[model samples]
Target: MNILIAGATGKTGARLTRQLDEAGHHPVAMVRESSDTSVLPHGVETRQADLTDLADDVCEGADVVVFAAGSGGDTSEEMTDKVDRDGAKALIDRAKAKGVSRFVMLSSIGAGDPDPESDLAHYLEAKHAADEHLKASGLDYVIVRPVALTEEDGQRDMTIGDGVDPEGKAHRGDVAAVLARAVDDDLLLNRVVELESR
Candidate 1:
């Protein structure tokens, strides 16, 4: 499978790209011209496109799309809305137009229901809109809502679905593993799952 990974240079996306490559799948790193490609695996395929300004051909040749992109914590709420909400929706639409097989979204835990009082409210709201968009996109989809993220190594032992503890933290590596598996894993197809380190 040829998987196009948005945010492929970021921590989790980078890990996911390598994992897919190691698993003998072709991983296409979707990046901006300014992005640092050094973190990507050697000889990995790349497609240059900015999340904020995507083209119709962005999803061309992709069998699946993993939206692992985000406007960083330091970015303004407007930027978050642009990248997280609008950018995601745009990509989803493009993928649908290009006939991509599946979409795997990396959403945060509280995205299903945002708390207005929380500091991450805006971020969660943006994600919530995107998640809803994906659900209604009429495409095969998998939404992975992981709790707080950590930089720890992947345990690969995860508590998924109803067994997930909301307060627990998930390792980025483990999240990456889950995202890569969602590409074609029949069990995860069209399902929304919460993830936590076991």
Candidate 2:
């Protein structure tokens, strides 16, 4: 599959790109012109694109698009809305325009109903908006909402459901594995799955 990984320089995105390459799939790292992609695996294909202003041809020829971008911890709420919500929405639009058939969104566990009192409420709200956009975009989509992320290695064993334990956590590597699987798994089509470590 020709998979376009937005935010390919991010922690989980980098892992997913590497894993897809190792698994004999074409993983195209979609990055911004200013992004430092030196940490990415050598010889990996890369395309320059700013998700905030996605071009119509950005997703041309891509079979699947995976959005792993975030605004980062230092950014403001507005930035989060732009990158997390608007950026994702832009990519979805491009995907549809360019004939990309599948999209996998990495969302947060509480995106469906963000708690107003939570510290992450703003972020969750942005994610929720993006998830809703994808659901209505008329494209085959998989929304993976993982709980707290850890740096542990990929275990592959995970519990996937709509209402998993709130206290559960997921390894970044394991989450990447699931995203890779969603690329070709017909069973994951149009599903919003919450992921947690078993």
Q: Estimate each model's TM-score.
A: 0.99, 0.96
Q: What is the lDDT of residue 82 in candidate 1?
A: 95
How high is the CA lDDT of each candidate model? 0.96, 0.91
Q: Which candidate leads in TM-score?
A: 1
Q: List the residue pairs that clash in candidate 2.
A: none
Tell me the tens digit of each residue's lDDT in model 2 across 1-198.
899999899989999999999999999999888888986889999999987788889998899999988998789998998999999999999999888989999998999899999999999999999999999999999999999988886578898886578788899998999988999999998998899987
Q: How much is 33 displaced in model 2, in angstroms?
A: 2.1
Candidate 1 residue-wise lDDT at 53: 94
Question: What is candidate 1's lDDT per residue for 149-169, written digit by digit as tens?
Answer: 999866899998997888899
Query: What TM-score does model 1 achieve against the real structure?
Result: 0.99
Off by over 4 Å in 1: none
